[model samples]
Target: MKIVNKLKYIGLAMLTLFVSACEEGFDDINTDPNSPVEVPASTLLTNGIFNVGYTYWDRDLNFEFGELMVQHMAQNEYTEEQRYSFATSDFNFRWGNLYSGQNVAAPTGGLYDLSVARALVEENENLSDAQRANQLAVIDIYMSFGFQTITDLWGDVPYSQAFQPGEYPFPAYDAQADIYTGMISTVTNAVNSIDTSVDGFTSGDILFSGDMAAWEAFGNALLIRMGMRVGNSAAVAAGFGGTLPTSDIMLTFDANQDVANPFYQDKVISSRDDFRISAELVAAMNAQSDPRLAMYAMPAPGSTEIVGMPYGLGDGAAFTLKNSTSDIHTNIEDDPTAPAYLFSMAELEFFRAEAIVSGYITGNDATAFAAAIDHSVAQWGASSPGYGASIAYGSSNAEKLNAIALQKWIALYTNGVEAFAEWRRLDHPALTPSANMAPGVTGIPVRMLYPNTEDGTNGDNLAAVGTVDLGTPVGWDN
Candidate 1:
């Protein structure tokens, strides 16, 4: 009887083993919940935010804006004699391409969609107290930087509801004035709130590799830029309610040299064939004896000297043997070696000079202006032999300002939007419309028209903006 009991127990044990084997059929498959959903904040930040910023640099939108602005400022006509096309008549001034109304989405909208700020705000909720604080600080700085760009171009935007499509599907437009004020306040607070105790920095910050110090400097630099933007408007400047600090936000572009510099490498469109330098831009560089000319424009293929034709001239215009083609080219679009600039030491110094001249801060305008020129030239790889000479600063304030504007123009050859904004503010190196410009389109456009897409999707909001003449001066020019 005892033996029979033992045999029955053995049979039961064998059956239990067989059932367990059937349940664990696949040993290699993963079932952990944490492993599948877990993505590092750094990866999210880089792939999402940095990638968008790099896109802007590659598109050459900035350079196109610069050409239009500078040509108008110089009062250079695009007459038929010069074979010029595009912006001959005022009606032809199309700002829509840059803004991407309904036909396409613009960089301004794209930035918000993939902003590290939004991601951090949403995902960091589960982080520890210290981690959460650091993450928020990073978001604050990035958001301010991008929003500032929007306000600088368009006076007003949908900021309150911006990036919150889920919450407010259609946000009312915020006044440009209000947006600027909020930007300053938010950036200042974020810069101050960055926690030094956090263990790891933000991983995908393409501009600043999660470095708190760099982020702080970038924030301050943006502040200085904003301060100068409103410098001409005492009413606007005063409305800041004393929250905007007077301290200058210093920044540098020597990322290759300074580990703290936030600049990073961006992918080039092609080994060759990106952008061509516009005739309008090249002529300006040539006239000023700008040292950065060589770095900006190469001699047309098969020629040693660079020659630029006027804007109004079409393909029919005469081209010297030294000139490449009669067509205008964006530097970044064409040159294989062209570098993309985010912010640079030269731009910072220019802001400082402008700040001093406008009484936003205290310093020698002339000295600061000269330093700005020097830094700009140096950045263009001008120090090498066979390169162009450096710009010389004259003694008087007017001469100094001229030098600053000239160099700034050269530095901005690859940066169209900035060049256009500067031309509106200073009206220097007078540009005229092309004599050959299309009929009825007279002079350079002061501001881009709202994209036509707004007409259909956000008709009410579009109407609220009213019909601003394409020729109407925007922001700083006012």
Candidate 2:
């Protein structure tokens, strides 16, 4: 899965010289081929941040796998994902575009570029201790978030020796248990490392232009998220209470399609209208009279009704049903700049409700549940009749827990990966497995398959590693 293309090794000077050799002002004698040019930390930071959730992540994680399995949407073409039969090659883009990367490479991963940015900050002679701390902390949070998410999705992965190509060309896959433990430490360090005294100077801080409060909250939000992922006994109490209010960390898009939300950019602006709303999601929303349904999807063409496509239909079958199924709404579609909620106050409220459900904290279940619903509505910026009156908070804590999980799933429409992770851990809404699954694919997949690159480049390491099936849960799922 380590496919960097070695393109980053090709320096800009070499390309320029090769192209301009016939130019009159070309001076091969004065140019030093050995001189190394480093890209600025600021540029790398923005690029890394954008790469994390945009392009590949949106397609592979959000649409291809997460949304399909979660029943948010079904693929209209190929439809292999809807059938729950995916190939190893289907996941190769994750490694090449997100998990594995090299310096200056096209499609550089979030952690790879961010870690490179961190290195630059650490090595800069002019930076003060506080300045370095401020910059490094941001990278640390992103690195930890990327590692945590990758491991959550794929189980055991190359973590400790992943970025260090010189030391371990074919890094051994780390165990999910060990990876989770390490991520807790890494995220904890990042959350505590923010130094507000020094300015986070930059020209390329796209997510949050040097806002220390936002950055620190982002780190804490990540910390709480990771802490909960592994079911830490003390995490609920320590990570919640008042902390939930201010710990939202997210990527906001402008109202312009020029730089709108990544998914918005791909589907609406790019005109890749390949996905339609899933019947499961639409039916559930309609049953509860959820007001967000209108904001989430549009009516079918030439029809005033809003319906979703049946889950896991073949391409031909879906084509026939296309007239009935709804597409994404203009609220999200026309407004290309709609914010892609990575982490938000609404999610924090759900965590609070979950903590109470797990007995990790003491709070009124109904109160917390209501708060979560309100937060979710506010997060969408859509007016609603509200969930309190219709969607009842059940009497028992067990029933409440199911409600909380299912409600969270509904609220997490755009954040498909996180929704999948929560489904694996919480097991609510009871998603049904697709009929007539593909060979080797079991019920709805709990984990992603390793890429085909491992079979060739690291066959020995791949062999030594344990088996990975879609049905098998990761280390933290229990």
Candidate 3:
């Protein structure tokens, strides 16, 4: 979206006035009665939406998701031989946080929640008709994308009644199936309604800069990704008649160079603080002689090889570095300014390859699959030495699929959520979990548990949805 020219004046001036007034107390207060209580739409969108998006995209949550999936994919094994413990629950809280009810704190006010989406939607209505429609379209895409991600991880979620705390003190949970269907439809409609002619969106659009075309592409790409979720289910597959054909769905990858890429700027609080390359992920890349390896990870101390540290290890063990190959020494590597990816042309190619392999689309599967790998490598900024020219695509169909998935895993270093989700679907580049890991986690967790708050506050609705253990596999897990 176009940068708001007035943001500096508003943000800085407001902060200055608020601080100055607070020091004066009630007697010196000169609050403008007619001034807007709420911040500008641009500031709100940037802080509420883009900021959160970048944080989530670059951090442990995304990495954990990818690590779990990669372990299940069999590309690597969780090695206690190494002392890397970031991915382990013992060192990082995310493992347990995700499974337990604790992580629910995010939905209450975090970016992943509906509050920002609602704010954008509500504000768009006050704009001119054309602007309103365009903004609404963008909001729909984001809202649907967010909700779909929530349902994917936690089967039953507060959807219809969610974000309306006053109206529904305890919102009912919607089934995963219903949520997916609704998300697809909502995103589709939004993509179709976008007005490409709009000059610019209100500043704060961190993903695409309010470029309607990019948003349109993103919506369609998301639809294709969602459609593949149910690809293995006969009933669901038949429902779509093997192919979910719609003008909105971009079945082929289009490399629009102008497409906005969300990355960390030279700011301390940006994406850099939240993420790191897991030893498990780095090792997988090294094994394949993957070109993206160096870009994604640094050489571990005392070794040139990129080895992965095992998950579920103790923090005390991290410094030992027995089997560890590399460590991210700076936040610059992990932060959003470090090129945190939301979506990319590479991902689009892989999706199409999957579609072709599954018979959902007509194409030369091998060609599409190989192209996917090539695109993914390029997307990862693999121009450095030691990076391989291309990922090896084995002769067999399974091998070809593995190659596609492996490259996807590499491409997903920044976008771990998608990588994790895809690994579950493809189940390739085999990974094995740590033997010392927790019980009932014999393999990777299939889905995350609903936040415990839902059970207490929205007990009846949660009860209706029934409880599924965090270990339960979903539609994507074969």
Each candidate structure's TM-score, on Cα atoms with residue i matched to residue i, is 0.70, 0.87, 0.70
* C-alpha lDDT of residue 26 in model 3: 9
Report the lDDT tens digits of candidate 1 across residue range 1-478.
0001112122111111000000111111111232222335454444334323433343323433445455511112323322223232321212222221111211121233223234544455567766666666666666566565555665666665443334444545667666767776766666566665563254556555666666666666666666666653332233222233222222212222111111122212222221234566667667766666676655766766655544444433433321354223233333433444556777877776766665666668777776776676776667533222334667666776666676676666555666766766667767766565555556766665554544544568747866675466665568
* Highest-scoring model, TM-score: 2
Instruction: For model 2, name the residue pairs that clash.
Output: none
**What is the C-alpha local distance difference test score of candidate 1?**
0.48
Off by over 4 Å in 2: 1-37, 55-57, 100-109, 241-248, 253-260, 268-270
| Candidate 1 vs 2: which has more lDDT | 2
Per-residue lDDT tens digits for candidate 2, residues 196-216, read: 656775666777788765677
**lDDT (0 to 1) per candidate:** 0.48, 0.67, 0.49
Q: Tens-digit lDDT track for model 3 on 350-444?
A: 77766777677666766665665666666555654423334466777677677778777666654656766777777765766555545445555
Error of 3 at 447 (Å): 1.7
Model 3 gets an lDDT of 0.49
Error of 3 at 397 (Å): 4.1
Superposition-based RMSD of candidate 2 using all C-alpha atoms, in angstroms: 8.1
True-structure Cα RMSD, model 3: 10.4
**Whole-structure CA lDDT of model 2:** 0.67
